[model samples]
Target: MKASVTDKLKILADAAKYDVSCASSGSKRNNKNKGLGNATGMGICHSYTEDGRCVSLLKILLTNHCIYDCAYCVSRKSNDIKRVAFTVEEVVDLTINFYRRNYIEGLFLSSGIFKNADYTNERLIRIAKKLRNEHNFNGYIHLKIIPGASPEVMREAGVYADRLSVNLEIPSERSLQKIAPEKDHKSVYTPMNWLKEQIAENREDSRKFRKTPMFAPGGQSTQMVVGATPETDHHILNLSASLYKEQLLKRVYYSGYIPISEDERLPALKQAPLIRENRLYQADWLYRFYGFEVNEIIDETQPNLDLEIDPKLGYALRHLDQFPVDVNRAPYEMILRVPGIGVKTAQLIVKSRKYGRVRYEDIKKMGAAMNRAKYFIEISGRPLPAASAVPERIRHEIIYPAKKAQLTLF
Candidate 1:
């Protein structure tokens, strides 16, 4: 007997859990002329489920019948899982009905290759197109770009998709070859480069003419799976930095490798590397927003992150010479380098400085993480934490405050 739509949804939804690149920020599609929904500039008001999947969007896979037998994938051709696919109209109905019930604010659709790249990509596009033209659904729609799909098809995709992504599952090409032999990095980069140019061109056209259609205003993003290969955090972060600078990507998602099979080629992990995944994100944030270089967070000397503490704290410990920054007198750039001061806290400190010299008590009021920052920041009249203190002692006090060795660093 053929599977019902509910059965297909259960299987495909489970398969889509591996993808963590579905965020609704940076899109501004409004519900004009009796449209069903809207995607705002402030982003969709969404929250995560207990397992970390973005529940605000109806995240699902159109199908899990893949042509490639990648070693790490759950839906690979060699897997003996029950497979099913949703028809284009069935997907449209689901989106429309689900929206009516307020179960989702938008749609995040991905699919495994069926027959070939173009065939699968076209089906994905058709779902988006129908949602826009037939049902007048104007909510956010994020579509995954099938690697090696023609530019012509991708152009149409940009028209309907608020954001597009291509998952670069492995950080290095050599690792990609060993794990997913049938795939190549070129297939992924080609589509990403093309989207970059087209989004740029579309912006220029829109500037010249107001009636020009939108082409992925939210921009492109990609994912790189961690712990699946031997590539260190250095290699992973360097690849991410290059993507942000060169490709002009909106985001680089880091998904921990979830061991799906006992294949000899893959690691036998009892759980996903969630901690390492979080550390990479923290490191990524430091590079993007905190004015730190990739090498500063992790370098040739220490390739992997210190899983015990965050990247910012690790940096402060490594370079003790820069610590105990004077909050009242230090430059805003230097203030950001302090481990306990966040971007917002740094800004607050700077803004308060214009009125008067920022004090230790005022910083506490701003919610600065003084436990860690106390050792790293110096306020006027308030004596500096003992700069002569050993780095190991500071690290121990920060990591384990209960053991509170009478620290030389206040």
Candidate 2:
């Protein structure tokens, strides 16, 4: 029996929830000359703005049928799930209709490998091509590149899509082999490398030729599943560091592993490691924006992130000797290492201190979370009291400050 479009949407959209790499940032496609839509602004998904307004996206899978039996995947061939695939026209129609109604700001399309990588990738490319050439969709489009797909197909995909991603589901090559024997790091990295080259060539061409077409203008990103195997946070962050340095990846998403099946090979988790997942994101932010190295966040001795507090605070607590950083005198790098000071705050401190000393009140106005920053930064060369520098005491105060009052009353 043929399913209605709504039914297919329900199935496919639900199937896509596990994929957390759908944040639409960095694309600047404007709707010029009366095109249907524009992506000149920040790409929207289920992400929020600083003002706390939520923007939505038409995030869904092209299909939920797979040929590989990856133990961690819900749509694995061995899993008994309802199977459905959207025709090219169906996806195009849905995207156009949804956009016209303002139901979504963009489209994020991924798929389970139906027959083979090439076949599935071709279908994805066709969807983007039809939307751009035939329908004149000037809106944002993020396509998930199929692993092991040909470079030719990938090149074509780049010509239409604003962003492309390939999920490296598992972190380590050995663990990936154990769960998904059909996939390897090469199959994932090869297409990523090809996309990197294509984006670079496109940029170079646009420099020389005024009207060169953009190839994945939003840049490429990838994801890795956390807690599925015995790999440590150190391993995951190291891989992310390498990707950022070598592949020049735009984002590396860490999705906490969700147990979809009762496979003996997979972990028997009662719930997803949401705290760890959030910590990984915080650590990733430190790496990207705060100028932190992977070793600074985690080491061989501390293999995992401290889930109670964020990575920056954890680092400050670990190395008490580094604080309290004098906001008016410290280098930008050292100011960034302070517990409560973010990149923006650190920048404000550096900019404002050029005139005179930056007081605590001034720092607070600059957006420093002073509750945490007060303990890690100095005011007019006055450091935090020596007693507050103890790592264990600081940890206790930061994690359970309310308890301190209760203990004092007792």
Candidate 3:
């Protein structure tokens, strides 16, 4: 007997959990009242199927048969996992039905590489094209741009997708070969470059056409698998930094590599390290928005981030001679690098300090993280946590590694 639509949704959504880009909060677009579009910043919540995972969209694979036997993927051909594919109409019906019932915001459609990259991407694009042009359904569509897919297909996919992504899958090409061997690094990055170009071109067109059509209004993003290989935190952040700088990516998601594929080449971790992924993200943030370079954030001297200390504090300690920034007198750039002060707090400090000298107590009012900030800031006539009187022993107690050797200059 054939399973019902809910049965397929259960299997597919469980499979889709491996993808990290499904968090539906980053971009916002709305649904038309009578039509099938709705993106309220929050994607649909109550469409829970058999799995306890939140139902954001009708997430599913276009096909499960793959050409690549990536050693780290459950969908690898060598793995004996159950396989399934939704016919284009079946997917269309499932999405339309799910939307009508208010189950999903849009479709996050991906696939295991079947036949070829172009063939796989074509099927994925067909779903988006049908959703937009044929059905006029315009919720959030996040389509995967299968690496090695032709530029023309990428252009078509971009036209319909709210966002497009090509998973980097592994941190280094060396690891990629060790695991996802059939996958090409050029294939992955080339399409990323293509989508970025298309988005830029589309943005330019919209600027001139005013009422011109929108192409991927949400922008492009990619994923990097963490701990799957011997790649360090520094290595991961460096790759992300390069992606952000050159590819003009919106976000780079980090997934802790789960040993879903039972390849002997893969690590047998007790559990995936979410903390490692989190630290990479923090480092990536510092690189992108915080105006820190990859070299400054992590380097040959310290090839990996201190697992215990936040990167901001780590930087401050390494560059200790620059510390004790005067809250009332320091420049904004100097204030921002303080261990406990974020960009927001730094802005607030500068803004309020202009009128009158800000006090230590007032610093916390602006949302500075007092515990770490207190060690580095002095405000008004009152010093923070009495920085002026803080003995060297106290500062040493807080910093990392407890090295008895003398601290060297940067």
Candidate 4:
């Protein structure tokens, strides 16, 4: 007996949960000239806007019938699971109906390799083309480019999709071979390199010719599974940095490996490494926004992040000599390195301090996390009492404030 569309949606959507690279920012497609929808500055998968507007996406997999038996994946071919696929028309109908009803702002579509990479990729491209040309749907579309897919099909995908991604499931080539032997670095990088060039060329062409179509206007992103392999956080972060620098990747998502299968080859984790995943995100943010290098966050001695504290805080604690940054006089870059001072707050401090010295109360008003920042910042040329500058004491106070206060009073 064949399943209905609703049943297929249920199965595939649930199967798609493991994929966490569905953000839809950085695209600016308008519903001009009477299109079905707009994707201007919108985010996907329930991501929020600046004013707290939550945008939702109909995130789903086209199918879960993969051909490869990756040891870490729930949809490995050897696993006995219910298999289903959505016809291209079914997906198109669903997107149009969902858009009319305002159920979703956009679509995020990925798929398990059904037969071969090119075959599966062609089907995905057809769906996007139908949505764009046939229906004039201008909504955000994020498509996952299948590894080993032909460059011709990938170029067609780039023409219609707002964003594209290829998941590097394992962090390193060695681990990738151990878990997913069928895949290799070349298969992944070849498509990624092609997409990067196409995106760049399309931008140049669009500037010269107004009628030129955009290629992955929101840029490309990739995901790496954390804790599944023996790769340290240092290794993962360095890889992320290289992707951002070399491939010009927009984002690198880190999914803490969830133990879905009971394979002896995989780790027997009680739960996903959610904390480490979050810490990596923090470290990544520092790299992208907070002007941090990969080595600065984690080094030879400390390859793993402190799961208890954030990377920024850990960095500040390790380099206490750079602390007590003069909020009234320090450079913008130095102020941004403060553990509790965010980019916005640091900018505000720089702007506000031009007229006069910034006070502790002013720092609080600017939204710096004073609890953490107090020990690291100076106000009115008065640093935190010299006793508080001690790294051990500050760490104790930050980690266990109540205990420290009790000890101080006694």
Candidate 5:
């Protein structure tokens, strides 16, 4: 007898738990054609792990079999692990059932290369097409773009998927070769470049048609496994910056490396760098909404992010030339540059400033974390006395005990 759908669900869902690119924000579901599902602007409510972290979607792998032995991957061909692959029907049924139960808002599908890259990508697209065209499912769908997949298949996948991702697992090309000899940077980036161009052209066509067939409205994103390769956070962020600026990605996920397989080819990190990953995410936020460039957050000397201070704080410390920003007088963008301030706090500054000049006390009342913000920001022409009086001393006092050399995001 064949494995039941429940068995497939356990295997595929377990395999997919490690993937973190399932945010459902980029596309809206159109159920005009009696479609079975739809992507709303509000996206879907998050699903959480047993530990209480958000799981969001019913993430799953179509197959665990692999032809390549990537050093860091547990599913490497050489590893002695139970393997499985789902037929297209199995995946489609699983997604619809999960969605009906409210178990997940959608599906995020990926696979280990089966037979060849295009073949794997073709299967992925078939699953989406079956859902969209046959099943008339309108729920959010995210598909992994297999490296070296043909542009035609990539386009098809784009039309079916709300979001697409191609993971750049390591920061540097040299490390990619070292860890996964069968793969190269070119293979990884080829589909990515194609997706970017397709999205641009599709959007332009939408301008003319008012509604060109939806093609990855949520946009494309990629991931990098931190700490597995020699490339520093600076290198990682620079690459991310390029991907965001050039490729126009919606997000870049930073994964901390967990040594799941024994390969001398990989590094010997004691544990995954979750804190470092958190800091990098914070830095990524700065790059997107805070008007920060790669040069501003990292450079040759500071290749790695400061594990103690978050990226916002670290950037403020290094560039005191721009500090003591007046929250009341400075623009909302400048307020976002402060060490401890986030997008929420920055918005509050804008709101309060319009009514009347905001005082230092008004900032605290507006929900600013004043202790950290005070060091890097001023209000109504008065710099925080302690931050200005002893900036470096205060910086060290705040961050010294918290620094860690190794960072990861597992």
Candidate 6:
């Protein structure tokens, strides 16, 4: 039986919730010629998760009728589920109408492979074109570039999409083969490389000529499914570091694998590995912004992250010899390694110290978490906690202060 658009919307929208890379930042497409919407660099906001991720986009799959029977995927061909797809015009109408009502700030379109790579990719491109040309939508549009598609079709896709992404899915190629036999790493990397070249070339041309069109102005990003396979956190972080360095990817999202159906190849998790996924993101942040290396976060000895403590706190606890840092004299980089001091707070401390000696009160007012920072930092005339200052004691105190206090009373 044929399903109505509302029925298709319910199924497709629910399916799209698994993708966590729909953040609408880093793109600034201003509306011209009195267009409908615009994507500002600040961000688009309609809904948010508990973690504060933006969910303003009309994120949905173009179709769920995939040819491949990936063991991890819900929409795989072998699954007993209703199948439906939207016509090209139907998608355009939804975007236009939804934007007018302020229900969505943009569109995030991905699809399960329908027939072949090119055939599926072309339909995605047509929908984006009609929105831009016919309806004049200048808002953000992020497209999932289909792997194994021709370079010509992908290049045209880059011209219209504000951002492009290709999900690596599994951390290792061997794991990918075991799970999704029909896909490979090469098929994914091929389109990514082409987009990188195009985006770079377009930038050069735009600088030389004022009217050069932007190509994926928000740049390219990729996502990896965590906990689906046996890859450790160390392996995952190393792969992510390489992608940021080699491919020049803007973001690498970590999606905790959700068990759809029981497959021998998959793990038997009661729920998604949400906590581990969050820890990886924190570790990734330390690598990208906090000037830490992958080895510093977790090495071959301790492959997985400490499920209880964050990666930053874990580092601080491991290297207690480097603590008792004097914020007044320490360099900005050293201050950043502190457990409670964030990037902003560290910068403020550096700037404020140059004017005068930054006391304990000053740092507290600057928003440094005194509960954690007080133990690690040495402020003038303010002594650190003399009791339980060792690594084991500090870890226990920070993680369980109430228990530590009860013992101290004895």
lDDT for 209 in candidate 3 is: 87
Which ten-residue region of model 3 has the weakest summed lDDT?
A: 401-410
Model 2 TM-score on a 0 to 1 scale: 0.95
Q: Which stretches of candidate 5 lie over 4 Å from their true place?
A: 400-410
What does candidate 1's lDDT look like per residue over 143-172, in tens digits? 999889899999999999999998899999
The lDDT of each candidate is 0.88, 0.87, 0.79, 0.88, 0.82, 0.88
Worst 10 residues of 2 by lDDT: 46-55
- TM-scores, one per candidate: 0.95, 0.95, 0.86, 0.95, 0.93, 0.96
Model 3, TM vs. native: 0.86
User: 270-336, model 2: which lDDT tens digit per residue?
Assistant: 9989899999999999999888888989998999999899999998888888888888888999999
Model 5: weakest 10-residue lDDT segment is 401-410
RMSD for each of the candidates: 2.2, 2.4, 5.2, 2.6, 4.7, 1.7
Question: Could you give candidate 3's per-residue lDDT for residues 1-410 as a string of tens digits?
Answer: 67565676666666776777765555566555566676666555655545344667667887677888888776788878667777788888888887887767778899988889888999999988898777878688889888888988888887788888888989888889887778879989888888888888988998888877777777888998888799888788888888988999888998888767657989988788877777787888788778888888899777888777778777776776676888888889889888788998899889988899888778888888776788777665445553534335435646532453445432
- lDDT, model 6: 0.88
User: In terms of lDDT, which candidate is stronger, 2 or 3?
Assistant: 2
Tell me which of candidates 1 and 4 scores higher on lDDT. Answer: 1
* Between candidates 3 and 5, the TM-score winner: 5
User: What lDDT would candidate 3 get against the real structure?
Assistant: 0.79
Q: Model 5 misses residue 347 by how many Å?
A: 2.1
Clashing pairs for predicted structure model 4, backbone only: none
lDDT of 1: 0.88
